[model samples]
Target: MAKTLLRSVGLFGAGMIAATLAPAIGAVDVGTYKELDQFMSVFERVRADYVDKVDDRTLIKGAIDGMLASLDPHSAYLDARDRQNMRTQTQGSYGGLGLSVTMEDGAVKIMTSQEDTPAAKAGLKTGDYITHLDGKLLYGGSLDEAVDQMRGKPGTRISLTVVRPGRDKPFDVSLTREVIQLKPVKWEVKNEVGIININTFVNSNTGDSVRAAIAGVQKSLGHDPLGYVIDLRSNPGGLLDQAIDVADIFLDRGEIVSQRGREKGDIERRYATATPTDLAHGLPIIVLVDAGSASAAEIVAGALQDQKRALVMGERSFGKGSVQTVLELSDDTALKLTTARYYTPSGRSVQEGGIKPDIIVPQLSDADYKARPRLREADLRRHLINEAKVDDKILEDDGKPDPRFQLTADGLKKQGIDDFQLDYAIKTIARMSQPPLRTALAGAKRGAK
Candidate 1:
């Protein structure tokens, strides 16, 4: 049965909801109604007294965004463009210049550009601000509007006016749009172990892709892979269902993840069931993640760690543990509402505290890893607070380097080594694959002489 959910406010919904939910539906109320009236009055004044005329659509959308922003970082209004982009991401292919961006300080800031995509090829770095798209100014406009302008048919060109930090002046770069197709799971045999790099959980067939990758790796190596390294570094997550499905691909049976919604009986749990071919066949698995691993990425990592199905390595995940349900509105618009908190099988929420790796391996080969501060849920404005007490280190900006990882990126580069975290994981897997000191020692070593 369909249930009533929290309503968004354009007409002072907080007070309106309070009225309907109060013990006396029609009870005597003064402060509540008066406050709502005051809000509407101000809203009207803004429409009337603003320096320039603003359309009702812009005003209403702004109000909606403000309302959602006040709640949490994930809750958002998806305009027609935003809705289509969300669909494109989850469905895997689209005609566009692939990249993720967000509104920051009145400009559109680039997040990590997807690998092999035009954005990455165009040398767009994280935090680079796009002031204009196709020569049209994006400042003083909605982020959704900017995103709409970036997507188009293959072979179409979009010129981006970029304002990169450390550069004296802004510059423009033209990129041809292409059909952005993500090979979500890419695998290779390294050190006799299969290393599967899951770029994203955006694609619907990510689980199948993983299975195929593993099987192909084993076939190419002419022997069973020593184990598997599931690389999730810098992977901004996508669909929740895909995360669950990917987690289940390796497990024989266990609860992958669960979500606790706002109301009772809203709890949903997903379990890892037997697949048609458990091709991996009880091999040791190591999952690698970093601060960029979030949402769906955390789900897979957390579930595997909790179930003891895989050893989670590398830094803690990005800690985006909230679930956003897209509620469709009129005219292709939607609402990305944060409705629940995701929990691992052990009932641990990956909120402000992300999934801590069983073996923490910092990326010592990436020169920029230390220079750039990692952002987590704790850093987000109006993020959902975790009820459990957390250590200051989780939220602290201790710029000091770790003694455990003393390898210099320059030295590693000279030695022809890159991706120190993956290198460490591969070495660890090699050690584990070595035959035990003895099948039983065969027998204890006798004292010499």
Candidate 2:
């Protein structure tokens, strides 16, 4: 069954993945031969007459990258460096500045640095833009290229010029590379509620870690506890199966998510009733997502919300519902292909317009909430389109203020309210646990400015 998985994957319009010699096999016809000849003609001309000397490998890699990139933003050619990086990811360790980054406006923008990592220790914040590496100007290279430069042997020091938001000047921060062992699940019992923060889905055993955390919280509390709050804010996604496992941990039954390929009627569904998957033990749960939440993170959030297993809160999530399947090539390289799109159990596709929470909660304590321009799958160049009817503009904020969110960031800061979203979730959980809190919250809501 494991061996036939690849063959079965082809049925979902990933037929090209299994075709190893498709170019040669399909070039039997005269027209196909002519097309192949045309490709070679351009390739030879660039190699022979280009002003700068170009190697066969460089030209071939460029051609491969272009071909895959043309398909979608998520698809790309992974060179040897990229393949090695993928291997490092599976090992759950990398010697680097320990920052998750993306290319935005010709700069390498930091997306939430992992805690206790070099990036976080060095005072890196989300939304800081790295304009240069070690004094050399960096004007937009691929995200992989920028990350490769930041990674080196342990103890190696590198400097980055960071342009922070609301700052007048860009500053340089020196950081030493270190081997980062990511702990995907961390839980703490706050006010008798389990606050589980799944930072990333990098590890295959993330679900197990979460289960252990939940158990530990229950053990420490010496009680069933009120509920759990799964915080998925600023969590850019990782492994797909980990997401599935995490979602299943909360869902007792029903379909979790489905992936449909380019071919019509070609889809695969993942269900949660397979093996007693509900690990929360039928407890009340709330999921918190922000504009930075995406991909695998969105998967778990959407599943729980669709199954009515958890209440989703916060702003619309960053829609990145496409699946990237890495196909290895003969040359120690690979192709990160976007084979299919993500769909909720309700058959709803939040491709560009991400999952809307049951209750929209804003980050009142974060002053930059109004100005923070977060990236979405829709913002990506050449992102895969959702065939389902979707209004991309629906994800945009109307610039209208909600009366319930009348509290100012400055006022919250004065009151030492660091995180309004978390505070709201805890209050909501407390209300759920004690009915009297609901009356208090209701009166406060009515009196809210």
Candidate 3:
């Protein structure tokens, strides 16, 4: 089946090609004679006429980059260093400065500091522009280059110059690189509610971590949690199957997600097959999402919300409904292509326009521009563009306050709800624990069963 799909995509590419060779066998024939002649001509010209010596590796990397850039945004040729970093990210462990940095306006800006990491420990806040790395000026360098320079052996020190928001002078700080193991799921029993903060949906361990968190909360509560606060803030999604597994843990039996490709009859649906292990049946649950919550994370939030299983709070999610398939090239390098798109159980495509929260919350304040702990619109610019529409019927117009529930620079000043959206979720869960609402939730669960 996989081979057939690949062949179909290859055929489609060939059919669309105007100047390329004809489609033959499984792969498209790229006019062998012409390619050979062109290659020799370029090689001869370089060897005969070049004034300066060019490194072979540099030339090859440029060629690879150019080739992959023509396909799509997600498809790229990763060198050895890039391949190693990709492995580190997926495994959720690395020796680094513990900050997610990106190239913004020609400077490396701190997107979000990982919790309890050296960057966070050293008071590195989001939106801080990194000007220097290890006392060397990082002006006009790519984010990948800066990040690679930051990662090194454990206990090695690196210096950074950062310009913070509302500050004119660049601040210099030195941090030590350590073996940082990113714990995807973080749960705590707060006011008798299970507050599970899922940073990302990666690895097989995420489902296990969530179960453990629930068990711990249940043990402390002397019963299963009466309510749950799922924090998916800043969670740029990871593995798809893992996201489905996480949703299955909450739902008894229902469709978690459905994916559809361009070809007809390619529709596929994944359903929940087991009863929930954490909260008892009909337990009040609220899922918190923001612009940073995306992809597989959006899948979970959208599924639960569509089924009326969880009250989704906070701002609109970062919609990333496309699916990427990693294709191994003849060389050791891989091609990650956006093959198909995924939809919520209700058939809403969260592509361009992400999932709208049941409760619309804007960011805390206009002037207090602290980067929310989730992926924002700016972060997703590098991803491929595949637009999908959302059904208006499934969306709720809960005319309350905007769910923008982060700690605004001003809100941080006063004693207001720092994370007002999460606070609202907690309060909503508490309210739902009342007899009447509990009965409604019970009915919903019974219908799901």
Candidate 4:
């Protein structure tokens, strides 16, 4: 019988595995060897006696995936396709809908859709679910597979069945794919204030772009702007080095961020470059964040807040403080491992408890902002624990209705304010730039008297 043969092979393979590993490890721990032996037994049994033939590569890849999946949600084995996708994303151009997504309960959930992308244009909001692609069910499939199906030749059309919370029934959205060219940093002058929107940190030229944005703002005004608003809302993070560079641009001195590995002494610290010129020239800055701001985005926000260089505004960020190091295993394969937990300059990790804003400015312009459920690092399966043990009570109470955020979407629209958060930030900057009315009128009053 197949069962009898499988049992015999499993016992034989266990002994063989112990004998093979003993010589290499030199007195292998009994417990570890037993576990490895059990693994080998299953592997051998599957290879020799499975109902249908299975390739070694498939089996090995599955094992590697299983191993990484046990560690954390972020760690994974990147195949050739995955590696290519990673490179494309970092380079800032890809053929897709330009959506940041995550797998939750075997369904692909939308994290955030990039501005001006097909997904964003299609009215796909954050926290929406893609239940089907092109009328085919996508649930119960791998995230990678769903992503691959979504990405194709530019101008290709794809239909998505979206299941959004608060909606009674699912809706279909038809989108034509295009090259999603991510502008890492976008700048504009509003009310004589420099508005620097950092959409992503994945691009290599993100730091340079920020510098250029400041220069552009100055050129437009023919003078230094009142202040700057660094908008980092819905910014999923990218490169660590890029984050350090961007933070250094504004900071003259002090630590930017520090990452700690497994060992106590295995720590690396990054500091801002000592420069004579402050890019903003000590101007009042407001770093705006929301639930969608993450990783490198948090790095920039955290550094500015900790150094007292900028007032962090808006909602708390997406707390993904762990650092991932990609180790290439082969020409086409690599291991993306969670190597360290990064801390802000003040030695606070934004793991589950993200960077709390000095001014909690909610996005009142969004009608569904209150009704929609937010997904964060704490919501992920097998997420790394914050050593400080984040207070659940604080997290639960964060969304409690504040009397300060009184503006509603319809009310804001009536006032011609489309983006409440950005408008609030710009207004704050404008107020900081002007001198006190009492001081300005003091001379006039004295002369009149």
lDDT tens per residue, model 2, 1-449: 01000001111122332244466556355565466567777877897999999977777778777887687767777677676776676566878977988787778888778867899888787778999999988885777778878988999999999887777888999999999887788889888999999888767788889889889988999878788999998788888888888898887678888988879998999988657756766667889998788888999999988777778999898888888877766466666777788899888887888998888999988776776666677878888777775785765654577787999889888887778998889888877667675455436434532
Q: TM-score for each prediction?
A: 0.81, 0.86, 0.80, 0.90
What lDDT tens digits, residue by residue, belong to model 3 across residues 226-245?
A: 69998987677878888988
Tens-place lDDT digits, model 1, residues 24-134: 566737787776667677778888999998776777778778989999988888787676766677675877887888777778977667877899788776667899888
Which of candidates 2 and 4 is the stronger one according to TM-score? 4
Pairs that collide in candidate 2 are none
Error of 2 at 125 (Å): 4.3
What's the lDDT for candidate 2?
A: 0.79
In model 3, pairs of residues that clash are: 234-374, 292-374, 292-375, 360-403, 361-402, 361-403, 361-404, 362-404
- Better model by TM-score: candidate 1 vs candidate 4: 4
**Alpha-carbon deviation at 219 in model 4, angstroms:** 1.1
Ranking by lDDT: 4, 2, 1, 3
Instruction: Quote the lDDT for 373 in model 2.
Output: 65
Query: Where is model 1 poorest over a 10-residue stretch in terms of lDDT?
Result: 440-449
> Model 2: runs farther than 4 Å from truth?
1-32, 104-106, 121-127, 140-145, 153-157, 165-168, 274-277, 435-449
- Model 4 per-residue lDDT tens digits across residues 130-182: 99999999879998899989988889999999999987999999999999887
- Each prediction's total of clashing residue pairs, residues at least 3 apart in sequence or on different chains, is 0, 0, 8, 0
Give Cα-based local distance difference scores for all models: 0.78, 0.79, 0.72, 0.86
- In terms of lDDT, which candidate is stronger, 1 or 4? 4
